[model samples]
Target: MDMRLEVVLLPVADVDRAKQFYAQRMGFRLDVDKPVKDDYRVVHLTPPGSGCSIAFGVGVTTAEPGSVQGLQLVVTDIERARDQLIEGGVDVSEIFHDATGLFHHAGEVDRVPGLAAGRASYGSFASFADPDGNGWLLQEITERLPGR
Candidate 1:
């Protein structure tokens, strides 16, 4: 059996505001924006070149707005991706790598200045957030590991 991640649900205070942030600012493609009833609405979006998508809206989730964190988006070039995000009006962090030369520590614990030495795959990263503070990390993966 092959299981795949298809959609992630995000909680938001205002659906339209979240929609604008993802669709206009983040540049995600809007797949759906439908009201199932007077009290229920769902907005679905997918990032460019991504198979999984994100959804948010009224009555969709009980989680608090801005509660989600550490969501990652993989890219072939961290610098280009970060630049595109900045040009699109997103506030992104400066590119950095973990001091331990492995995965990054949570919440800026071991963040070192500048890109990883030799620009190793999966080593460089930048961070940003949505209007509701759903944190996102852009990880530069130039090559995939075996079995990925």
Candidate 2:
């Protein structure tokens, strides 16, 4: 069997705010943002150059709005990634490294599954959220990452 990522569903209480954050702040392209019903809206956004997009709305319930726990979008250069988010007015953290390598930051990060005993990667990254607290990790892997 073979599989590839197609889309992700993010939960947010305020669709408009979530949409704005992704589009205006994160540079995600607004692929869809329209009314599905009264007081309900569906918003979809894709990274600047990505095939996958994240879907969010007011009524969907895969997870509670602002309840998205851990989501990481890996990149090649974390510093540049963090800079872009900062330029967009998003709050970020200082860069740090560990055994695995180096990493930036993301909402309260826990040990990623299968990471070495006490190693972190070097990449300027950080955590930020949507209106409802859907957390995200914008990471940049400077050296060879585990999965790569």
Candidate 2 lDDT, tens digit per residue, 54-144? 9988776668787875577776666678888889987765544332344422343443433323333443345566667777776555467
Candidate 1 RMSD to the real structure: 0.7
RMSD of each: 0.7, 5.0
Computed on alpha carbons, the lDDT of every model, listed in order, comes to 0.94, 0.68
Cα misplacement distance, residue 20 of candidate 2 (Å): 0.8
Q: Pick the candidate with the highest lDDT.
A: 1
Please give the TM-score that candidate 1 achieves against the real structure.
0.98
Question: Candidate 1, after superposition: displacement of residue 143 in Å?
Answer: 0.8
Across 21-82, the per-residue lDDT of candidate 1 in tens digits comes to 99998899999999999899999999999999999999899999999989999999999999
